[model samples]
Target: MTRLDAYLNRIGIARPSELDAAGLLAVQAAHRQAIPFENIDVRLRQAIPTESQAVFDKLVTQRRGGFCFEHNRLLSDMLAAMGMANRVLLARVTFGDPPALPPLTHCLLLVTLPDGQRMIADGGFGGTYCPPLPLADGAEATSGDGARHRLTQIGAPGTLPGEWLLERMGPPETSDGRGRDHAAWEQQYAFELADTAPADLVMGSHFASTHPSARHVNCHVASRVLPDGFVSLLERQFSRYRAGHPVERREVADVAEYRDLLAREIGVDLPVETLDRLPLWAGAD
Candidate 1:
């Protein structure tokens, strides 16, 4: 079978009759639901490859998930194989307090529609919107999971000069208790239209996976976007988020439970030996 066929099968979605906006949204949503955003390889000390084939083997063949570099790279490859126009773009993560101005540490896809409009087709960002968002500044898009998102342009305009900030719109009530005001907009990440090369992605992946200060190095994180809510596994704790409802959380009792959670809920196939070697909930309280 062709790569496109393999990808379509991997995401459990039927082949689209046409590569229009509707088909793009369907494929993106299916991918997010099937594949999870995870850093298990980094935690296991396994080398994370940024090459397209390597990523495909791990994600599709092995049924494993990866961070942005691997996830977005594979998505771009699938889109190209299906005759879609796409480009790789880099982004700096600014999700935390006092937003981090780090180097381009995230990779995403910029897809061009037939009508010449650009859309951000990202399958890597955990718990974010699923459908492709229009790249136009101040345009809002909602995902199949009922989460709202938008993009705002920043800095001066030129050939990829200004950065685009992706913001997630929170719920109207303050019951979530995330310490933010009610109905606040959270900054997910910032990116530019500048061209991103494969080497650039490799560098970013290397640093993110191996750097001592990187959060992925110390924390084990896995997240999957579901139809009605989102599921996240951080260390040994698992949390579920549903729209207009309180976040539900619990801790895994032991290593077996953690492994079962990864395999059953996150669709990861980590070997038992690897799970035995790695620390499960070392630093978590």
Candidate 2:
């Protein structure tokens, strides 16, 4: 089968007759459900190959999960195969109130639909819009997994820059250590509709995957969007959410537990030998 057919099968979706909003949403949700965001290879100290075919082989043929670079590379490539007009954009992931400024290391898509409307296809990120997010500023959309999201422009009035900030409706921080009652818009990431090149993604992935202190390299990270919620594994801690609210949490004890969770919850099945590369997916002791 052609890679496109394989990809559609992998995502458990038939090719959309017309690539419109509904079709895009279906693909986005299915993609997230099937291919989780993960960094096992990076955690294993393997060099992340950023080539399109390499990513396709690992994600589609091998039936594995990967991080932003691998995820969006496959999406952008599939959109091209579908004859959709889309381009890749790099963004700085700011999970709201980041202790330090981050660099642009996230990948997303700017797709011009047939009707001339634009949407952001972020197939990788967790707690993100399930459909391609609408491009209009201040317009809100509900995600497939029950989360809410919207875009806001940057800069002064009438002098809006190309950069767009993405935010999700989440709980407000509380000083009492107990959760607050009100919901607030939290910054997720920001990106510009500027031209991005393939090399840009490769460069970013190289740094993130190779840098000794990078988060992915230091811990176990994986996430899969559920039909009604989400499940994430990070820093040896596993969390499950329902309706965008946390419902469960636990720490993975050993490699066996990690392997089971990776398979049962996150939809990834690594070989025993591969799982041995990281004893506990831990950081500094």
TM-score of each: 0.90, 0.88
Compare the candidates by lDDT and give the number of the best one.
Answer: 1
lDDT of 2: 0.75
Deviating ranges (above 4 Å) for candidate 1? 157-162, 171-182, 244-247, 281-285
lDDT of each: 0.76, 0.75
lDDT of 1 by residue, 227-275 (tens): 6667778777777767657877788887788888888888887767778
TM-score of 1: 0.90
Clash totals for all candidate models: 0, 0
TM accuracy, model 2: 0.88
- The alpha-carbon RMSD values of the candidates against the true structure, listed in the order shown, are 3.1, 4.0
